[model samples]
Target: MTYILQLVTAGLAVGSVYALIAIGIVLIYKCSGVVNFAQGAFVMMGAYLTFAASRLGLPPVLAVTLALVLMAGIGVLAERVVLRPMLKAPVVAVMMVTLGMLIMIRASCLAVWGPDPLAFPRIFPDGALELFGVFITYNYLTAGVLSILLSLGFLGFYRFTAVGLMQRCAADNPRAALAIGIHTSNQVSLAWAMSAGLAGVGGTLLATLNGLSLGLADIGLIAFPVIVLGGLTSLGGALVAGLLLGLLQSFTDGLLSPMIEDLLRAHTRIYSVGALQQVVPYALLVAVLLLRPQGIFGRKGSERL
Candidate 1:
């Protein structure tokens, strides 16, 4: 039971990071109707930025903040430079452009930061807290708490704020919103900026948890299963799905893998089943799509789209 609790805690921490990145993907999809494949690249870039800032003598908090700000600017620039021209293009074209953007960003990061993985500075105090006989690290606790807080704050913003309402309006119907005097283009730009900024924070959190590396961007791929399971248009769905996937992955890694391995050893010739946890989310994603295409919190009408 204690081991289970420990695994759960660890899963929640990693899942929270996925949820953050997933939220960014959902935000861009909701507002612009274009899937931003460059999200992983943004994560990679943000980690590099944080690493750069740390090298320049800034503390972790300041470095993360600076990285977020710069990422937001980069988001805006990406929208202006890469997306704006393709705004009138087909959805497939826009998506491909984003794929191109991802490649460009990855190459740029490699050129500037090089191909070596660097150790990220510790953001939280180095220690673990014991609760009910389970040891939980401050890094995990901080990341999980902060991710939840930020997600809730974003939810509140979407629920009550004027800017968020404008964003929603733009997302719901860009032409109608423009006809009604809202600046649709500006709203789209804001969405990209916010989405990129959130992705940056997620990246920083991940780097702090795991060491900094180009591979951190692969979290974006993990996020796809989260968003698909949660529904692409639903923020709340993203949160719940992220946490669920995280916990599930953790549990599988900690418990199920060993159990399955032992069972296989006793009964079959198979020696190992490697990284079963990584496969879980994708499997869940496929099941969700086939059985409940609308997702847990997704609106019924959205299934048509």
Candidate 2:
């Protein structure tokens, strides 16, 4: 029981960061109808930029803030320069462009930061909290709490703000939004900006946990399964799905892997069932795609034929 609690706690902490990044992806998809494949690049760039800022002697908080600002600017630039021109292009073309952005950003980071994982700058105070026999590190506690708060805060902003209403209008029907005097294009830009900012913060928090590396960009792969499971258009669904996936992966790593290994060793030549936890998300994705294509909170589209 104690071990289970420990795994749960650890899962929720990592899951909160996943929720943050996944929310950003959902935000862009909702507002612009563009699936951003460069999201992982934004995540990687955010961590690298924060590292750079810290190296220039900025305080940790300030470094994260600076990274967020730069990331938001980059988002807007990408929207205007890359996506806006392709607005009338085929969806496949736009997706390919985003893939190109991802490749370009990764190569740029390789050239500038090189191909080495840097030690992440310390953000949280080093310590651990013991409660109910479940040990939690300060890093995990702080990151989890902060990510949840930020996720809830962003949801609140989207639900209650005027700009958020405009964003929703733009997302629902750009022509209608334009007819109503909303600047749909500006709303799309804002979505990208906000999405990038969120990803940047998520990346910074993730770095504090996993160290800085180019591999951080691959988080987008995990996030894709999350968004698909949660409903691509539903931010709240993303939050819930991210946390659920987190907990599931944790349990698989902690419990199922050992159980499976033992079973396999007992009956067969296999002494291992490697990285089952990593496969869980994709399996879940396939299940959701087959069983609940509309997702938990997503509305099914209507054909107007």
Candidate 3:
């Protein structure tokens, strides 16, 4: 029971981070009608920026803040310089450009930081909290709590804030919004900025847990399964799905992996099943897409001919 509790704790912590990142993707999609695949790159870039800031002798909090600001700027720049120009292009073309951005960010990070993982500065003090025999480190606890708080906060902002109302208007009908004097293009830019900022913070928190590395970008890929499971248009769904996926991955790593390895060793020549947890999200993604194209919380779209 204690062992199970520990796995659950770890899973929730990591899952919260996934939720945070997924929310950003949903935000961009909602406002702009564009799927930003480069979100993961934003996550990676944020962490690297934080690392760079810390190396320049800034405190941890300041480093994270600076990185977030930089990330938001990058997001706006990408929208203005890349996406805005392609407004008349095909959807597939825009998607390809986002993918290109991801590759570019990854390559840039590799050139500037090298491929080796760097030690992330301690954001939280060193310690562990034991509750019912489950040891949770301060770092993990802080990250988990912050991620959940930010997720909830962003949801509230989207539903209750003035800017959020404008954003919704723009997303629901650009022509109507424009007729009413709302700048739909600026709303799209704001969406990208906010999304990138969230991704940055998520990345920084993840770095606190997993250390800084280019592979952090790959972790961003997990957000897709999360958003899909939650429903791409549903922020609340993203939060729930993120937590669920996190728990699923954690269990696969701690319990299922060992159990499978033992079973395989006794029955076959294979010594291991590599990174089963990583495979689980994509597999789940496929299942979700096949079983429920509209997602758990997403409504089916309708069009008038």
> Cα lDDT for residue 226, model 2?
90
Ranking by lDDT: 3, 2, 1
lDDT of each: 0.88, 0.91, 0.92
> Largest TM-score belongs to which candidate?
2
- lDDT comparing candidate 2 with the true structure: 0.91
Query: Runs in model 1 with CA error above 4 Å?
Result: 301-305
Q: What is the TM-score of each candidate against the true structure?
A: 0.96, 0.97, 0.96
Better by lDDT, candidate 3 or 2: 3
lDDT of 3 by residue, 1-305 (tens): 99999999999999999999999998888888788899999999999999999999999989999999999999999999999999999888988999999999999999999999999988899999999999999999999999999999999998999999999999899999999999999999999999999999999999999999999999768999998888888889999999999999999999999999999999999989999999999999999888887777887761100
Candidate 2 has a TM-score of 0.97
User: What C-alpha lDDT does candidate 1 achieve relative to the native structure?
Assistant: 0.88
**Superposed Cα deviation of residue 257, candidate 2 (Å):** 0.7
lDDT of 2 at 6: 97
What does candidate 2's lDDT look like per residue over 229-286, in tens digits? 7888999998998899999999999999999999999999999999999999999888
RMSD of each: 1.5, 2.0, 2.2
